[model samples]
Target: MKPLIVKLGGSVITNKRRRFTVKRATLTRLARELSVAKGPLVIVHGGGSFGHPVASKYGIAEGYKSKDQLMGLSLTHRAMERLNSYVIEALQKASLPAIAVQPSACAVVSGGRIQSMELTPIQKMLALGLIPVLYGDAVPDLSKGMSILSGDQLVVQLARELGGKRVILGVDVDGVYTVNPKTNKNAELIQEISLSNWPSVEKRLTGVVEGRDVTGGIANKMRELLALAERGVEAEIVNAAKPNILKRAILGEVGLGTRVVAR
Candidate 1:
């Protein structure tokens, strides 16, 4: 079987309004749930409170400003480290042999995009029955010196390289909707989306509710998944803000979330 790509969104893992805070109980529960998966899992996570705040302030995503931006980049990396450490510890406590890998160390970025990703470490980790956890981070950019790469972009790269047929995103919302549910009361939950209706669906999406994200947020996520769908890979979005939904999605359950089908 091909490896599964799962993304733990920042909204699901942390309080976006709170600075540098993680939802430990939710993460631990998710780890325990993921511990039972029988297939190889490549987990990619968003920056959430840890990365987005600092990077947004420094315009890191804008890419290669001055040496002054280096301070913001350094601070972003440190925050990612701290957040990843907590996640790794939680996964380990759940008996999942999860290892942390930095995207900047292996992936080459240029023009705010990943030009190349070194997948050797991820392959080896999966072969050894371990989970490889990747988080959004600032990476060297040939065009600008460095750029903030989003986890959504990493999911597409992982799925393409690892022979993944599906990419799952656990977010705060139950699934993709016709409008921003957080604000619009008439927003309808879109149970399924595919190439045929993607253009319209893309029109309905609302960007981030809170938090400073240099990455394009949900808009970026939709475009990335749409690209994957065009390649015959499907992406699922489930509600991770609550509980148990993420575990269920990881277990390959369907009908509980929105499914992005190939056109």
Candidate 2:
């Protein structure tokens, strides 16, 4: 049984461009499916349409301003918590034992590195057969004051630390593509990527999307997360919009997605 770390993309949950509202049916289905999974599980989700656009609207994206940053941070944190509660409750209703642990509360990042990850509690819960859920939000940083930690980045770090044999990142697209599939119909899904070939992938990503889009985006995410694969931690990017893919990935069954592994 591999230690599974599944990242729930914000876009899949909420339409951030509009306003933050719970995608009730999707979350309900996800919770139902995850409840019966047979393995140690850790879940992370993005802020989606709820917190991010608000932060961007108030200029919170450019690192937090002391005053507005705090306000923005408060808003962002609350929004994530709201989503977290909804997920947790749904999981509970589905008979899945789960707990929500806010990374900002116990995680400490110094000099842009995860200096420490206090995982004893999470480990304890997982050992007791409870799923631990984390999300992307504002976390404290010694140098930058407060920083936004994407759920994607958090999963990469957690997968490395937990030594998961594989990490499956469910995203909005088919998989890592040569171009944003939305804009470029010609974009082809690349089956595999390595750290060495990432430069070429990054170069080809011009204007199809923003860096942050690529932050959680498959190509760039696979690049940053390649270190885990180097250590023999397999990873993949799949479309989260699909209803049943998560269950397939959890079962170690082949499903739609680009698999990223060590070359």
Candidate 3:
């Protein structure tokens, strides 16, 4: 079996309502869930409160335009690193050997996107029975001078370059819903999404999400994740906060969450 590319959604792991807070109990639960994955697991976590707020304040996602963005770059990277440290520590406490792979150090960015990645460090980390924990980060961009690469986008890049057939996103919500579940009591969960229903699904997926998310939320993720499926990588969006949803998804258990079809 290929390595499972698992993304721990920021909202699920971080207490975004507060500044720089990590839900330790939530992460501990997640670590337990991820422990059951049958194949080698590559863990990528969102920056959560640690990343989004600073990036938003600095406009890091807008691509570099001024020297002033440099301070923001350092601040944003440091914030993300702080979050990564918490995640790694929690996983380690769960007896999962994990090491942090700082994205900015190893990934080459251009035009505010990952232009190239040096995979030897990551490949070697997995080979050593240590799971490499990566997160959304700021990196040098040729076109913009600097850009914030989101965990969502990093999932695709890692899966593509590192050889993963299954991509999983563990979010706070059960799965994709017709409306933002937080705001609408009448929101409906859609079980399976493919090209067949995406046109209609896309229309119903609109709503403003509350958070400091620099990377676009679920709606934006759907498109990139679907494109990943089109390349023969099957993806799932599950409620990672719920017990065993992540484990079940990794184990290929159906009826748990929304599955992005592999076409």
Candidate 4:
């Protein structure tokens, strides 16, 4: 089996509005689920409410040049670090032998896109059977100077580099749906999505699906993931709160989630 890249959403880990109050019990369950997984696994998480608000306050939404923006960016990164530490601690408690490998410390950016990802240390960790946990962070960029790289984006890079055969995003929602399940009782979970139909599916999605999704919400994530699918990587979006979903996917069992695939 190829490597599995798991992206845990901050929203699923904490209250959507508060990132510091780590949901210990939920993550404790998640860590336990991942601990028993087989072969190499790479875990990545979002900043949730922790980094976004602070980064917005500093006006670092895109790029930062001003001192105020820089200050805010610093706080934003610290917030990510805070959340990262909590996740790392949880994994350790579960005896997963996880390591916090900060993306900013190694990645160099050009323009607004990722120019390259070193991933050497992560590769070494996987080789040693150690899980590498990465988080969304503010990183250096040549075009805009420093920019925030969402964990979702990092998952794409890592998947490509590691030749990840499976990519699972654990989000608040049960799966991608035709309508906001919170409001529409008739809303149905989309079982499979192709690259050709992603845009239309994305446009129809609403509620809780917004810019804040570190995994880029339904649309952007589908776009990014479909591209990866074309390269032979399989990706899915499922409810992270349900620990069984992760295990089922790893076990190659038919699951209740959205599978993004090539056209």
Candidate 1: residue 247 lDDT (0-100): 75
Clashing pairs in 1: none
Query: What is the Cα-based lDDT of residue 182 in candidate 4?
Result: 67
Number of backbone clashes in candidate 1: 0
lDDT of 2 at 55: 60
In model 4, where do residues sit more than 4 Å from their true spots? 183-186, 199-203, 206-217
**How many backbone collisions does model 2 have?**
1
Best-to-worst ranking by lDDT: 3, 1, 4, 2
Q: Which candidate number has the best lDDT?
A: 3
Kindly list the per-residue Cα lDDT of model 2 for residues 34-104, writing each as its tens digit.
76567898999888777676566655445546686777778878887988898888888888888998988
- lDDT, each prediction: 0.83, 0.74, 0.84, 0.79
For candidate 1, write residues 140-230 as lDDT tens digits: 7999887888888899998988888678888788887766778779878888877788778777766343234667756666667877888
Off by over 4 Å in 3: 208-212
Greater-TM-score candidate between 2 and 3 = 3
Given candidate 3, what's the lDDT at residue 75? 94
Off by over 4 Å in 2: 196-199, 207-220
C-alpha lDDT of candidate 1 relative to the true structure? 0.83
- Model 4, 95-116: lDDT tens per residue? 8888998888888876546788
Per-residue CA lDDT of model 3 for 115-231, tens digit only, reads 888999888888778898899998888788888888888899888777787898888888888877888898888888887788888888764232437777667777787888888
